[model samples]
Target: MHLLIDQGNSRTKACLYKEGVFTDVVLSELTPTDWLSIKQGLIGSVAAAEQQQQLQSLLPASLAVRWLRSTAQAFGISNSYQQPEKLGVDRWLAILGAAALYPNQSLLVIDAGTAVTMDWLSADGVHAGGWILAGLHTQQRILVSATAQVEAAALSLHPLQPGTSTTAAVAEGAKAAVLGAVQQAIQLRRIERVVLTGGDGAFIQQQLNNNAVLLEPKLIFYGLARFIDNN
Candidate 1:
């Protein structure tokens, strides 16, 4: 069995794979106890050592673990970025999955979690770099938290129409800004195969009309699994 772990800023995702296929998946708060439970029955695990000590304490001493890092190995894709190591592993894995799934097609992978990241990979297997921006909730919360004038009610994503009140207006505006930024990234890349994943992926996809492919949030885990399989 192979275990894939994605330790993101907000949550930790785990997937158990057997015989080259994913058998089960789970998401948990990045807590010591939760980590320990998920590590049981896994032969090996892969993740970034963001909280290395805490993670080490949770796993059995015999378990083999690997940390993901960007490299020049070119997993069937050409990384055009000047510094491949500077790319985030999460984004790298996501694009890898995109390339593997949609081979011979240009792709735009958008991850809308704590932050929105849009990465481009060409059909010829080239990593064309990407852009990052604040997510909808992140932007709204930052504005409200940084300023005393804004209220929490003003950031709700209710009714799709234009806001009738000041609070609604603020919330709607924030959402629009996030969507606009994502749209602009997709447009600038000019890639039709846009894959959306992350916390707000569904919402973002909805706002994007039919311009993108909405993928499950576990796309990164699948990518990591593919990497392990190929290696």
Candidate 2:
């Protein structure tokens, strides 16, 4: 059994996989009991140093842990960044998952977490680079912080209609930004597959209303499994 941990800016996911298929998943830090019988583990983290160490301490000494980092190339995916190591590991791993899930098809992999990241991967396993933007909540927070007039409000998911009030306008604007980014990305490239992952992926898919778009929240794990296989 292998434990795959994807530690994001706002959340951490620990999954138990047997033979490359995950059997269990936890959103918070795993207990020592959770590590029982696990022999090997892999962690891909973009969290703070303290958070990383907190999780690291929870693992059993007997378990061999591998910290996954961005590289120039791996698992057939060629990263396009000039400094490949600077590429976010979460995005890198998600691209690996997208490549394996939809082989030979150009893809737009969107990970909508604390920040929204959209990475384009070619059919031939080449990463053509991607975009990063303030996420839905991040946009809202910025609007409130930067402007004195904008106030925080609980906004629910609604159709993209013109807003009548200040709160409504703020809500609609944030969502529109995400939609606009997606539209611009697709128009710039030929995306054969659109895969959405992360916390707000469902919202993007719902707004897209495209039956072809796939929602795979566990995409990072798939990438981790592929990485393990290559090793």
Candidate 3:
């Protein structure tokens, strides 16, 4: 079995894949200690350096862990960044995942987590760059923090229509901002397919109300596996 670890800002997702399919999945604040049954794995992380070190220290010495990073070019994907490594590993992996999942199609890949990110990949495998913005909760939190009078409770729903109350306004406005950004990105390029991943991906897609939008929650894991197989 191969363990695929996607360690993000708030949580760590671990999956066991064998024969091109995931057999088990776990989500936790830190890597679970009970994964000793696996012998090899790939880690695609956006956590702090210190945190990553802690993760490495906790892994079994017998387990082989390959850390995935961004590059100028890999597997026919040409990164557009002037300094490719400066790109976030998660975004790069998502782009790789999108390309591998839907080959020969212009794709706009969106990962909506603590922060919402959108990356574009051409059918020819060119990284057309992307945008990053505060996520739904982050936007609401910022508004609450930045202003004194905007007191509101946690949002129960996100409505595209104008909100009738303070809480609704805050919640809906954040959703509007994210949806607007997605629409803008789609207009900026000839996106043939729109793939959504991350925690808030489904929410974004639902708000957009587009049946064409795809939710691929396992995109990063697929990218990790593809990168490992190629290299």
Question: Of the candidates shown, which would achieve the greatest TM-score relative to the real structure?
Answer: 2
- Candidate 1 vs candidate 3, TM-score winner: 3
Model 2, span 1-231: residue lDDT tens: 788899998878878888757865763456677667677898899988999999888777788889998999987789999999999999999999889889999999999988999999999999999999999889999999999888765656676888788988888888899989988998899989899999999999998889778999899999888766446
Model 3: per-residue Cα lDDT over 38-99, one tens digit each: 76779999999998988788677778889988999988999999999899999999999989
Error in Å for residue 181 of model 1: 1.3
Write down the lDDT that model 3 would get: 0.85
User: 2 or 3: which has the higher lDDT?
Assistant: 2
In order of listing, the candidates' clash counts read 0, 0, 0
lDDT of candidates 1 onward, in order: 0.70, 0.87, 0.85
lDDT by residue (tens digit), candidate 1, 26-136: 433334553454433322222445565565565556556776766654568866667877777788878877777778898888888888898888888888888898887
Where is the poorest 10-residue window by lDDT in model 2?
23-32
Against the true structure, candidate 2 has what lDDT? 0.87
Q: Give stretches of model 2 more than 4 Å off.
A: 27-34
